[model samples]
Target: MLDLLLAAEEGAHAEPTAFFLEPYQWVSVAMVVLIAVFIWKKVPGMITGGLDSKIAAIRAQLDEAKALRAEAEALRNEYQAKIAGAEQDAQAMMDNARREADAILVKAEADSSAMVERRKKMAEDKIAAAEREAIADVRATAVMAATKASRKLIAEKHDAGADKALADEVIAGL
Candidate 1:
């Protein structure tokens, strides 16, 4: 380190650093100047202005995104509240439905029982009418049989004299 320092000090006493930048060395500086000139001449002010506007637009877009995020968060909270209320309403509706179903079931059972009783009464009436008809038919048949037997005993188709004598005896006995 000390040797490099001593060598640099000795070289400084030889000549100036700017003077060492001779004409050939100045070519590199001229190229740097040409690049600066190209930037100044070729690049339009409108392009730079448009770039600045684009940067501003990007910043504005970021601000808008932040606002949209806040809005989305608010909407999420509102919808969540609505969902909770709807859930409560749904539970109430389910309970109401169950109660209504139970009432309907009880009513249906009562109506069915009444209908069954009416049907039983109708059947009993029919059975009683059939029994009465059967009894009447049996009485008519008994009377017919008794009348046929009595007619057979009182008749004498071929013996008119005998029938007349029996009829006189029956009348005298009476």
Candidate 2:
């Protein structure tokens, strides 16, 4: 060792050696051995298989989520259709009620008019009956007065000769 160091100090060039190889060459050899050991143990295959399983699990979860979303959308559409139908039904009911109210009002008006006409006719009939009764009473009073006047005139003019004359005139006329 001392001789080798002296030779190096004398400007004599010598290649560095370890285990019959240079240091850089030994590092390359160590790397090759480490790669060979990894291959023997199948570490690469284990890593790839684990990654493939994780990818399959994630895809299954995504499919489940998509199915759930589709189901929820269908339910929402069904409820919306039912709400629209209910609104239409309510509108129809309101229209029917309005028509019924109009019909009832028209009937009531007709009935009231008819009743008024009947009451007017009854009042006219009562007035006509009263006028006829008054005429009959006037005729009865005039007939009684005429009978009294004729009786007085006959008594004043009457004698035995006029009585015989009146009997002969009545016989001749018959």
Candidate 3:
């Protein structure tokens, strides 16, 4: 086995001896020079710095997005509070309106009742006045009828003999 390995190593060295004279060897040397030039110019470092700057920009964008989201959430909360306050104010206004309506209704009812009472009182006063006028007219008619009847009776019953006797009696008394 040791002799076989030695024979393989000798064959490898022999192949390389002719490789130096081949076109492939020139290509290999050119590749090595190119690699050395790239290292001297620090191309790998520039690529790494560019990639790091991109990562930093992406991180800054993410931070800005988070800040904007927080501000939007705060604004939403403030609007919700304002909406709640507006609802409360509206409810209070409705309550005040209801109370005012009730008060107005009560006042209107009282005014209507007072007006009805006044109308009733005026009607009663008119009726009393009419009754008093009727009574006065009846009394005046009775007095006039009695006066006429008495004058008729005196005219029929009185005579000149009675009148002379009444005059002589009145003279004796005097």
Q: How well is each residue in 136-159 modelled by candidate 2, as lDDT tens digits?
A: 889988988999888998888898
Tens-digit lDDT string for candidate 1 (153-173): 767453789878989999999
Residue-level lDDT of model 3, residues 1-174, one tens digit each, is 465578797884423435436668778888999999999999999999999999999999999999999999999999999999999999999999999999999999989999999999999999999999999999999999999999999889999988999999999999
Q: The CA-based lDDT of model 3 is what?
A: 0.91
> How well does candidate 1 match the true structure in TM-score terms?
0.40
Task: Give the Cα error of residue 60 in candidate 3, in Å.
Answer: 1.3
Model 1 error, position 92 (Å): 1.5
Clash totals in order: 0, 0, 0
Q: Predictions ranked by lDDT, top down? A: 2, 3, 1
Better of 1 and 3 by TM-score: 1
Clashing pairs in 1: none
TM-score of each: 0.40, 0.42, 0.40
lDDT at residue 44 of model 1 (Cα atoms)? 67
Query: In what order do the candidates fall by TM-score, top score first?
Result: 2, 1, 3
Candidate number with greatest TM-score: 2
